[model samples]
Structures are given as C-alpha cells and as structure tokens.
Target: MGRNVKSRIESESQKNNLSLIIIILLALQVILSGVVLLRIVNLEKLIGGTEASEPVPVYVEGVSEGDNPALGPEEAPITIIAFSDFQCPYCASANQLIKEIMQEYPNQIRYVHRDFPLKEIHPDAFNAALAARCAGEQGQYWEMHDALFSNQEDLSIEKLNKQAEILNLEMDQFNNCLTTRKYENKILIDLQAGKEYGVNGTPTIFVNGYHVNGADREAIINIIKDVL
Candidate 1:
C-alpha cells in the first residue's frame, strides 16, 4: 500500500511539472505576439508621419521671367517660367512636358526658360548654359537648347562645340561667347532669384507666379487648365 502511494505521488509530481511547462510556453507565445503587434503599430505610425509631412506648395511673389530664352507670344495671357538645370534628368523631362504643353496651348502660354545650373552636382551644367546662350547670339537659342537636352549625357566642351557646328553657327563667335562666359552674370542672377523664391531643386516651375516645385505633370496641367 505504501509503494502504491509513493508511485501515485511521483505521477502527480510529473503532471504538475508538465502543467507548469505548458503555462510557460503559453506565456512566451503571448509575449512574442505583443512584441509583433507593437512593432506593427509603430511602423504604421512612422509611415503616417512621413505622409503627413509632405511639403505644401509655395506661392512666390514677384517670380521673374528674366531676360532668358522664351517661346510663344511675349504678351501671352499666361506666363510659365521654369528654373532648369540642363544636366538634370528631371529638367529634361520637364522640358519635354513643356514642349507638349506649348504645342497644346499654342500661343496662349508664354514659356520662359531660365538657367539654374546645379554646378556642384552637374559640373557640365554651367558650361551647357553658356553654350545655349552662345547659340542664342546667332539666333539659334532654341535649337541649341534642344540639342543640349537631346545629348544630355555629353555636355563636355567638345560636345558643345560639335553642337554649335551642327547648327551651322559661326564657330569663332560661338566659341568666343562660350569661352568668355558672356551669360555668367545672367545665369547667376537666375540662380539667386531661384533661391529667394525657395527653389531648392531642378525644374522648379512657376505658373503665373505660383510655384510648382518639381516636374509634377498633373499639377502643371491642372494649374494651366485652371488658369485658362
């Protein structure tokens, strides 16, 4: 009888130990679930914060058209000014969009192109701006402008010269104009004006003095449509 009682006691002890182990496992699972849920919540909050912090569009006062390359009638009802970098891909895209916009709107929109060369990042950009202006002296500004953007991967001095030749510009005059940097002051003025107007990146556009901060196709179209 005593042996049977001892055996029963051992069995009861084993069952108790098994129950404790199961409880511990359940507690660990609960902790892991809580940690995962907390992480998910925090991740959601971070994404929400980021979306909430998107910059609001700026309305700049006195945004100038500048003495720069232009398309469409001078006295067109709408003036669209762009501060662009020739070496910037976004600027190139914006340039194409502007072309389409001009074609669509015809003579109603006056589109002006101003230099805002990001010389630090795009070492060739300042020179490219000069090349365009040099070609402008020969009444082929838009032609050179198109050429530079079309061959954006290569805006080296040699390439600029080749482009001038392709356009049949008097090479001596174009070379002198580019080498002397005749439009340096004008380009600097444009850069300074862009800073004042809160332009921190390339292809910052102004539609009737209202700032559209990027190559935002939809925003640009909407603004122009609304204005018209």
Candidate 2:
C-alpha cells in the first residue's frame, strides 16, 4: 500500500512539473511574438510607407525677394522664394525638383534662391554660397549653383576653385570675390530673413508668400497648382 501511495504522489508531481514547463514555454512564445510585432511596426515607420505629412500653408508676410539668383520672368504669376543651404542633401533634391518645375511651368513661375547656410553643421556651406555668388559675377551663377549641388559631398575651397575653372570663370576674380567674402552680408541677411519667416530647416520655400517647409514635393506642386 505504501508503494502504491508513493507511486501516485510521484505521478502527480511529474504532471505538475510538466504543466509549469508548458506554461513557461507559452509565456516565452508570447513575449517573442510581441517583440517581433513591435519591431515590424517600428520598421514600417522608419521606411515611411505613406506620403509625408504636409504642413498647413500660411501666408508669411514680409518675406523678401531680395536681389537673389533667380529664374523665369520677374513678374511671373508665381514667385517661389527658397531658403537653401548648398551642403544640405534635402536642398539638393529640392533644387532638382524646382528645376523640373521651372521647365514644366516655363514662363509661369519665378524661382529665387536665397542663401541660408546652416553654418554650425555645414562648415563649408557658407563658403560654398560665396563661391556661387562669385561665379555670378562672371555671369554663371546658375551654372556654379548646379555644380555645387551636384558635388555637395566635396565643397572644399579647392573643389570650388576647380568648379570655377570648369565653368570658365575668371579664376582671379572668382577667388578674389570668395576671399573677400563679398556676399557675406547678403547671406547673413538671407539667414536673418529665413529666421523671421520661421525657417528652421533647409529648403524652406515660400510660393507667392505661402510658406511650405521642408522638401515636400507634393506640397510644392499643389501650392503651385493652386496659385496658377
């Protein structure tokens, strides 16, 4: 009888142990599944499956269209004033888009590029802006502007000089203008104007006085469509 009782107790204990092991395994599976699910959601957010959220367009008053590098007719129906940094990748992308838009609209839009180099982050940006302006003195502002954006990864003084040569600009004059920092005050004014217009980032564009922040392609197009 004692043997029988011992056997029964051993069986019950074994069963209990098995049940606990099973519960632990289930709990582990649940935790792992939750972690995987969380990772998937985070990945989705990072990859950006949807279109970027657009900011509400506000008519920013006193936004200056100062004597900046511009394209298209001065009296076009839509004037796009862009505050940009030459070293900013987003600005480069936006520059291409703006160029395309210019081609698309042809005579309907005036596109102006204003300097807003983020000096702290992009050490070479201020100088790059100077280089473009120097090239402008030789009647190749847009050419140098395109070159700078194309070679944003390398905007050293040496590279700027090389680009000037490529554009056949008078090297002495271009270098002198850059060395003198001829457009320093003008760039500073643009930076100040950008700050006043609430431009805390690169490629901040104002279309006919409407503020469209960031390199938002759709927002830019939609705004232009509305204006036209």
Candidate 3:
C-alpha cells in the first residue's frame, strides 16, 4: 500500500513538472514573438526614413507663370530645375558649370532657378534671394541672377542695391520692393517647394525630372543627351 501511494505521488510530481515545463515554453515563445515584432517595427521605420531621403522624379508643377528665372527655349525637350542657395560655395561653383551646359545645349535645355536658401548656415542668402526676386520684377531677373553669383562674397543689402544699379533697375522701385518684403510670400513658396522635392542641399539639379545631386558634368551631359 505504501509503495502504491509512493508511485501515485511520483506520477503527480511528474505531471506537475510537465505542466511547469509547458508553461515555461509558452512564456518563452511569447517573449520571442514580442521581440520579433519590435524588430519589424523598427525596421519599417528605418525604411521609411531612407525612402523619404531618396530623391524622386517629379513633373514641374505649382510654379506660377514667370515666377521662376529660366533660360533657353520655352519648348526645350529637356528641363533642368535647380535648387540653390546664393551664399553656398558649392552653389557658386555649380553656377559656371550650369551656364556652360546651357551654352552647350542652348536650344535643347531649359534651365530654371528656384531659391532654396539654407538660412541656418547662410544668414545673408535669404535676403539675397529676396533681392533677386525684387530685381525680377523689373524684367532684369537674369542680370541680377548673374550679379548675385558673380559676387557671392558681398551678399549684403548694400551690395545688392549696387547690383541693382549695375543691372539698370529702377532704384526707387527695387528698394521699395526690398524694404517692404514685396515678394516674401513668393520666396517662401520657392523654399517650401524645394524642400518637398527632397532638396536637402544646395545645387540639387534635376534634368528632365531626374535628380542630380552632384556636379558630375559628364553625367549631366549624358542625361541631357538621353532626353534629346
């Protein structure tokens, strides 16, 4: 009878042990599943950030008529949209390259300039952009555009006034436009438009809607050729 009772107790102990093991396994599985789910969520966030940073091709839209400073034929097969800051040295470097490209493919390429001044790093760039827009009002946008890039070191209001004089713009009208922030809303629109197109840095060039982040002359020529 004692042996029988001992066997029954042992059997119950084994059952209890089995139940504990099963519980442990289930708990472990739940923990592992939670970990995997967390990893997947984190990975998704990482992918989202990468995609946001990548440049995507976009059609020209939202820009008003005569709002953008442009060169080349209106019906050119290729269009280059440039997001640039006046005070950025890289943008200054790219200016001559862009001009050369336009000269090379004068009829085939239409280049548009959009303001994307990084005011955090370049405090004078925003004012320079404003000055350029004010000059645009006088039908001398391209001339002021040239002067701004040529004398990038002197981007002060005084220098911009002098540039307006050189471009033969009426000082009374230009100064009033500048002082009164006549095109402040327009410039802000340009800056926001550039940001939406993933223009994180200066001189972000797009040829026929294709993103060109670097100043690779050969690559730019090839893109232009492909569109042509």
Candidate 4:
C-alpha cells in the first residue's frame, strides 16, 4: 500500500513538471514574438525614410542639370545656381537653408534651381520632378515645389495629386501634363547642361556662375559675400 502511494505521488510530480515545461516554452515563444514584432516596426521606419512633393533638379539628356535657367546680367553681382536632387537628403536640407538665404538677400540675390535626379538611388526623384512639371503646366510650380519639399516623404501619384488639388490646379491638365511627359525634354535639357558644366554629383552649385564643387551653406554664403 505504501509503495502504491509513493508511485502515485511520483506520477503526479512528473505531470506537474511537464506542465511547467510547457508553460515555459509558451512564455519564451511570446517573448520572441514580441521582440520580432518590435524589430520589424523599427526596420520599416528606417527603410521608408522620407518623401517629396516637388523636386527642382532637372534631367537634361538623362544627366542632372542646374536650373539657373537664364543667367542674369554679368554685373548682376550675386548669382547662386543650386544644383539639387529631388530625393537627396542633403539637397533637401540645403534647399530649406537656401530659402532663408533667398529671404536674406531678397532683391540682391538670384537663386536658380537645377535638377539632378539620382534615380538609381532615389527611385522617386524622377516622379517628384515629373509632378512638379505637371504642376507648372497649370501655373503651380512654386506651390508644388513648396509642397513637395515640405511633404518630402510619401512621394506618390496620390500625394502629388493631392498637392495639385491643394494648389487648385486642373487635375486633367496636370494628369495630361504628366502622362504626355510635357516637360520630359525640358528635364533632359537640364541634364545635358549639367554635363556641359561637369556636374557629377548633386548638390553641385554655381555661385556667380562658378562651380562650388562642395556646396555647403557656409561655402555658398562666403561666395555670395565675395560676389556681393
């Protein structure tokens, strides 16, 4: 009778041990799942990066070009031609700073925007520029430009359309403009110009028509000061 009782107790203890093992396994699984989920969330945010509403760099002959358009009088003093990419992070920052510079100089400084979409790295750069040109067709270039740079992330047709809508552009005109690639040649022309000027990377700038190879804000300011 005593042997039977001891054997029963041992069986119960084994059952208890099995239960504890199962519980531990389940807890470990839950912990692993939580860690994986958190990591995935962080990875996604890191990958998405940023977006754009409008991009200034022009694609000339498939090369990025400065959008200085027409040069001012040789005696116009301070001229800043900023070559930028719609998808470049540094260019984006530079552009924001450029706005302040523009404001500071106001009438005295002339700042031109050049387009050099590094589509290889920035897949959406071309699309963003395309959207800007579409907006320009409806006389909303600057409006779209501000919107693109402001939104800088989430650069998609839907977002571009929203920007156009906000600027009160004719959707049909904008859509048609984008579809027909109305400004494709214009962008290509800008790219060719960049080639002529030996612009390999962006945000290569030209201050007073001189290439500011490494275009940092201070460099630009100093050049402007010299020209001024």
**Comparing 1 and 2 on lDDT, the stronger one:** 2
RMSD of each: 6.2, 8.2, 8.4, 15.2
Cα-based TM-score, every candidate = 0.76, 0.76, 0.70, 0.65
Better of 3 and 4 by lDDT: 3
lDDT by residue (tens digit), candidate 4, 119-228: 78878777788888778666667667767777877777788878888888988988888777777776777777876878878887776665654546766777678667
Put down candidate 1 lDDT per residue, 32-111, tens digits, no spaces.
Answer: 99999999999999999998764545678989887888998988878889899999998988999988988888998898
The segments of candidate 2 whose C-alpha lies over 4 angstroms from its true place after superposition are 1-53
Candidate 2 weakest ten by summed lDDT: 46-55
Strongest candidate by lDDT: 2
Q: What lDDT score is found at residue 178 in candidate 1?
A: 91
For candidate 2, the per-residue lDDT at 52 reads 51
Give candidate 3's whole-model lDDT. Answer: 0.83
Q: lDDT per model, in order?
A: 0.90, 0.91, 0.83, 0.72
lDDT of 3 at 199: 73
**Better candidate number, 1 or 3, judged by TM-score:** 1
